[model samples]
Target chain A: MTFFINSVYFGMVLTFVAYEIGLFCKKKIRLAIVNPVVIASLIVGAVLVLGKIDYETYSESVQYITYFLTPATVCLAIPLYRQIHLLKKYPLAIMGGVFSGVLTAMVSIYFIALIFGLTHEQYITLLPKSITTAIGMGISEKMGGIVTLTVVAISVTGITGTLSAEFMLKLFRIKNPVAKGLAIGTCSHALGTTKAMEMGEVEGAMSSLAIVLTGILTVIGVSIFANFIG
Target chain B: MKYLKQLAIVLIVSLLAELMAYLIPLPVAASVYGLVLMLIGLITHIIPLRLVEDVGDFLVENMGIMFVPPTVGIIACVDELKQMWIPLLVAGIFTTFLIMIITGLVTQALIKKTGGES
Candidate 1:
């Protein structure tokens, strides 16, 4: 029993270490898709399951860190604050990019689900997968989703964005920070925003703005469409 | 005086936004409307940044603490999640990856067209 508690500590330590290693790999590997957070989280999650370390215990242990999501998100306003002038300069362009990006994410999921014949519950979960965890989970609840599934989906999407975004952008010949930021937030929400921040301020700011907007639009979009579907 | 006023405004604004969700014929709830309205206020200086400023820093510094109740919620779902494991897992993984690829593609194209700026 004692070993189990200690193992949870090791699990966390490994997660951070793996994340740092992923960061280092960026230079040597020259690959954008293999992000540190993704690699670390996956490695850690797998280890916990394999070790039979009890997910509940581990989560309880790290519950403190997860709570930081609110402040971390609110701090987004700091970056947005810096780029207020930039928004004024190209309101139309930014709005076009972000709204389109948000719609694309939501529609893509809905269409695919329709083709696959997903249940109403699954569709609800899909609705908020593109937004940040807090907002996504909140929306999922309103729409009658399984919050755990939504959270897991959200975390996975976020980690994927953090790890793969840069390389994907480059591979596809993407260079606009605003576009990059919008894509990141629209697809992955808060976790992706962290990586966006590392890229530069404009990317960070645009990503933050996208997070807030994506949540609003997605909620509105889902509710309206779900109404018609019913 | 300050916190009370801020709380009042948040409550009122959030309520109005919630009302809008019904009027606008959308699937989303009122908090979302409140969020958008709040952002607009901040953007236009209709609401001062000062109001949400301290709230943010405090929240960030304490993020890890907020995830407890939810994490516990996930734990309690062990049996239920297992029952629907296949679909949930498949949907979670499939949709996340799909959204990432397509959105990245579309945005990359848009950026190229927009001259990759602004």
Candidate 2:
């Protein structure tokens, strides 16, 4: 029993099972709010709690999955590389869009977090919330924020972006695929890219480009500008 | 064999990037180093895109799944979230739109100014 419980496969199987369940629901419900990660985390969290399995034990067994995160993030370079033509064609537009996204995210998060009276750790955790979890978690760690909070915040931001994407696009009267995709990807990261893909091929590609660029910009911004926020 | 080879190529690149990030004093994320280096290699033809395309596509396609496990870390922060749910939700919802609107507007304005399309 001990061997089975501690075996890496134990946690791996649990996560896969939980994710499949989440996928099933996502297909049936067709709702962005029913995000696979959110659902999987809830089920996995419940299992660990009910089974009296500690967080440390669960995380330890699932170390392999976490390790893949670094490579998966690196793989994002593939999309950026593929979209290099767009970069050359409208370099200023793309960079300008991403810059605005990063600046707005940081300034808004800073003020909102302060207005809500968040602690320094909470503020820092949320500082990188607009970027993907992989990069956001790194920024959170470097800035002395709670990694867990940052991850959760990023997930919430992604879900919000996915759910409200259409409304926001219509509200903004954004017609350009480049603009639309960049906005979605910058605000919500990969999940928003999924939505952008649904809109059209060009939107998908632009969003893919936006995700990488926004990740880079946000990392630079948080590392340098975080000191000014407090 | 094909998949393994592709995966190995990406793994090596990632490992090298991680090593370089460690040696460098910059505060950038190691994964960003891996990404930038990989991009440079691909553009310069040092690493052909096809070599890692299969495994890279596979990983990017399933990236969401990989993120699930780390999110379980949220369980550890449940109490903190409970205490701050309102502000957290407001911050998330408000700022998400703020970024979206600002980015979209900026991109559109730039495109119009550059004479691409109105």
Candidate 3:
């Protein structure tokens, strides 16, 4: 038993199993809140806590899975490439929408943190909340924010986008597929992109493009905004 | 064989992107550089899409699972989360809705103004 728990495969197996369970729940429940990543994280967290296993032991092996995050992020270019024509066609709209979205995300979080009297560390942590975890994590770490808190905040932001995107789009009477995708991706990154993909191919493509652009824009944006609290 | 070849290309591109990121003094993540390089490669025909499409698709499709470990780190910050839950929740939920609405409205309005497809 000890040997099995200490093996390199332990964490990988745990993560894969938890994720599969999460996928199963999503399939069965068919609810946006039944997020696979969230569920898997909860299950894995519970195991680490309840089993008296420290996070380091579990994460050492699980790091292998995260090793793919960078490569996976790079592969986002494929979808963006497939949708390059849309970018050319609506360059102004897409670029404008993503820029404003990134701006709103940063500015709004700043004010919210100020109103709530959050410390600078907390403020910076939430600054990159709306982007994908891969990019958001790096920004948070660099800005001296708590990386784990940033991860939680990002997941919360994503789940909120996934949960509310369709209703929000409909309420706003946002009928354009491109706009729908851009909005979701800009606000929630790839998690919301999943919802956009279900909306339509164009929405999915546009959403993926928004993810890349929003990430780049936020990288530039945060450097400037980190000084706001300092 | 095909998948292996495709995986190799992606790994190489990712490695090169990491190298570039290391050499460049910027706040940008290596993943961002990798994505940009891949886009440039596809656009210029320097690296054909077919060379990495299958593996790329697989990676993107299963991307969410990759975040699990990092998120599980939240356990380490339980006390901070307890202290900051309210602000975090308000900021997260409120700003998310605000960004979606504002961004969607702006994009939709711009598309109309630019006379693109409605």
Give the candidate number with the greatest TM-score: 3
Tens digits of per-residue lDDT for model 2 on B21-110? 789865456777788788899999999999999999788767766767766776777886886677677767899999999999999999
Stretches of candidate 3 exceeding 4 Å from the true structure: none
Local accuracy of candidate 3 as per-residue lDDT tens digits, A1-230: 67978999999999999999999998999766688888998999999899988889998988889899889878888888898888888989999999999999889988987898888898898999888887888889988998888888887888789878888899999889899999999998877876787677788778878888898899899989989986
Model 1 per-residue lDDT tens digits across residues A1-230 = 56756664654555456556656776678666655555555555666667666667767666545544443554566567767776765566666766776666667666756765777887777667777776677778877887778876666566666666776767665576766777777777767777787788888778777787778777778776555333
The most accurate candidate by DockQ is 3
lDDT of 1 at B15: 65
Error of 1 at B109 (Å): 8.5
Instruction: List, for all models, the DockQ compared with the true complex.
Output: 0.20, 0.61, 0.69
For candidate 2 chain A, the 10 contiguous residues with the lowest summed lDDT are: A193-202
Instruction: Please tell me how candidate 2 rates in CAPRI terms.
Output: medium
**Candidate 3 versus the native: TM-score?**
0.92
Query: Each candidate's lDDT (Cα)?
Result: 0.63, 0.81, 0.87
Candidate 2 C-alpha lDDT tens digits along A150-211: 77788788878877988889877998888898899999987677677667656766777777
Q: In CAPRI terms, where does candidate 3 land?
A: medium
